[model samples]
Target: MTLTIEGFDHRRVPVADGVSLNAAVGGSGSPVVLLHGFPQTHLMWRHVAADLAADHTVIAPDLRGYGASDKPADPDGRAYSKRTMAADVVALARALGHERFALAGHDRGALVALRAGLDHPDTVTHLASLDVLPTLDMWDVMRGASAAVGFHLYLMAQPPGLPEQMISASADAFFGSFLDGWANDPAAIPSDVRAEYLKASREAVPSIVADYRASASVDVEHDTADREAGNRLQMPVTVLQQDWGAALGYDAAALWEAWAADLEHTTVTSGHFMAEESPAAVVKALRALMAR
Candidate 1:
């Protein structure tokens, strides 16, 4: 079955050089772009998007290299870097006549949103990240046994050939594990969305791994330079994450403080897919952040 969110108009919007993002746009008022995470599409915001659309223009897009978005091949893997992906979102919004927009992301999308804030502070009016730590803190807290549940991160961080090959061989099981495991209620995803996710992952193996590969290399370097230079998110930054720090023995909020000057850090009981598991909380947080 063809999966879609009601009240959203899907578009292949041009953004950055050599790329266009597949976005679902709806509603009016100030623009708000919602980005999807790994193993899922913008449909994850089905409930929240419509609600926000009543008050804001909601632009939900499959990040480059995922869903129906155009994936450009670039050497050195810089193309898939979060910095590049973030730029895609900013440009896409600008093309839609929004010079600045309220931006929110879940999981991998959060990483892209993080970069958008740093790289284009003037473009992103407010920033909300769901269920993820900033890249630097994420690597730091993955010490000792904290890395156990994040085996996929380690696997995809390796040199491309093997991870891509192995995952492609069993795409359904690989992606299904996260879709099932990370949700507070697995039924929140439903079966058709699950099938769409598996299909997208199967078709985009190399590009998907490239996104992760860039995270381990170029993405990290970009983040480190920003940190070393004492650069922080200039806007009101709200980070909504699962309490992985509690289980991993770290202060997730404190770690975020280092990167965000004006910060609202929160830990929710929902699993990794907080937007799906707890739409009301996600919507409330976003409305507050966008209020800034």
Candidate 2:
């Protein structure tokens, strides 16, 4: 009855001292890890993962604090930071017998993949980020009236109590709004999968808020430090994004080029949930990135 990536074997792989990630892995040959974004699970990768599995081993995991993954408490706000999350990805891959692999992510997962590429260059052979900018660039660009579009970011960035309380008060409405509003094709996420996303988000309010909260705080500090030290992704990177630049008054590709020397940035026509909305295009772009 549960929706899942068909043909993939699911496991709870230990990645930290006491935390583990719920991963769905399939296929063989070179490995490719896919990370899901907010309000969704590895199920988001069902279409793309199935296609990729024909040749490349595809491992799609629900990131920490989301879906069926362990939600460790964030007593000091460091628990859900992208750095910590990125580390989990590395450890997960290694535990699954992969010392090096291609990495790709969508939304929040893209942010994690970016950090992993920056922090562990030799381990990630190639990188792809879907529909997200880096943490520092993200905060830098959201200004004036256009910033209002990301009201949820500001809301979840608030200190622990209020954000969790308000979101929990009406979890379905809060999480469902994005699912309903952000997709170009609503049928891309059918009723069962949408129900699953809403259910997972409804139960993980505090941890989800902590994940977003870190982006506004500790994640920014880490990104700022990296920028100051001139740290960059030392691998081929591909970024697929919607044309948020024209509307927000900034160049997305130029911004990504600063962090990656070998970068291919493409503006996608699909909605924010591009992997589901345009799986063939996503698969093609990822295959090209891996080839490079």
Candidate 3:
């Protein structure tokens, strides 16, 4: 069966620089934009988005290079940089008639949300990140053996050509590896959604690699400058992770504290894909974040 987010109206919203993003808009109260991570598309938020739609206008989009959205490749990888991606979502919300909105992101989308808060504090009311650390702290905390687990990070970070080719060579296996490995409960991702994710991932190899490549280079630069300037997210920020701190031997909360002035840090039980593996808990957390 073809998977779809029920009740949401899908549209291709044009943002800046002649780009159009595929977004699913639903619900009716305060706007809350939902972002998905790597190896998955906006479909990752079906459960949470549907639940939140009851009380919030949920806008779930395929980040520029992922899902059914436009993919524009850049030689410097700047186009896929978190800064640009953040701008896309901010523009996306604005075009949808929301000047300011609540933001929640999982994985790559979370990184974009972090940048959005840093760059557009006045626009993003609340920020919630699922299973990720700030780009700078992420590179900092991930050292020695802990880094090995993210071999894909290093692989995709290299100069463009090769990483794209290699992953594209075996896209399904490459994408499926994460879908299988990360979820504490494999059944949390239904077969049709899994198929959709794999199909999207396979078709988005180069653009996806560019997204990761930006993280290791330009993203780090953007994050480092913010940290050096003593800038932190002015809005309320909450983070939910799988307690990688214990395994990686760093205080995840303390690291996140450095970036967020008002932080609500919680360790989740659902591996990396918390939204899908445990949607109720994820929805409850976001609801609480917005409430605060």
Per-residue lDDT of model 1, residues 216-269, tens digit only: 899999999999999999999898877776678889889989999999988788
lDDT of each: 0.89, 0.95, 0.92
Q: In the order shown, what is each candidate's alpha-carbon RMSD? A: 1.1, 0.6, 0.9
Once fitted onto the true fold, the runs of candidate 3 whose alpha carbons sit more than 4 angstroms away are none
Best by lDDT: 2
Model 2 lDDT at residue 159: 87
Best by TM-score: 2
Candidate 3, residue 291: CA error in Å? 1.0
Q: Lowest summed-lDDT stretch of 10 residues in model 1?
A: 68-77
Look at candidate 1 and tell me the lDDT of residue 67: 88
The TM-score, computed over Cα atoms with residue i paired to residue i, of candidate 1 is 0.97
Pick out the ten consecutive residues of candidate 3 with the lowest summed lDDT: 1-10
lDDT of 3 by residue, 61-89 (tens): 99999999999968666999999999999
Which candidate order results from sorting by lDDT in descending order?
2, 3, 1
Candidate 1: regions farther than 4 A off: none
Compute each candidate's TM-score over C-alphas.
0.97, 0.99, 0.98
Pairwise lDDT winner, candidates 2 and 3: 2
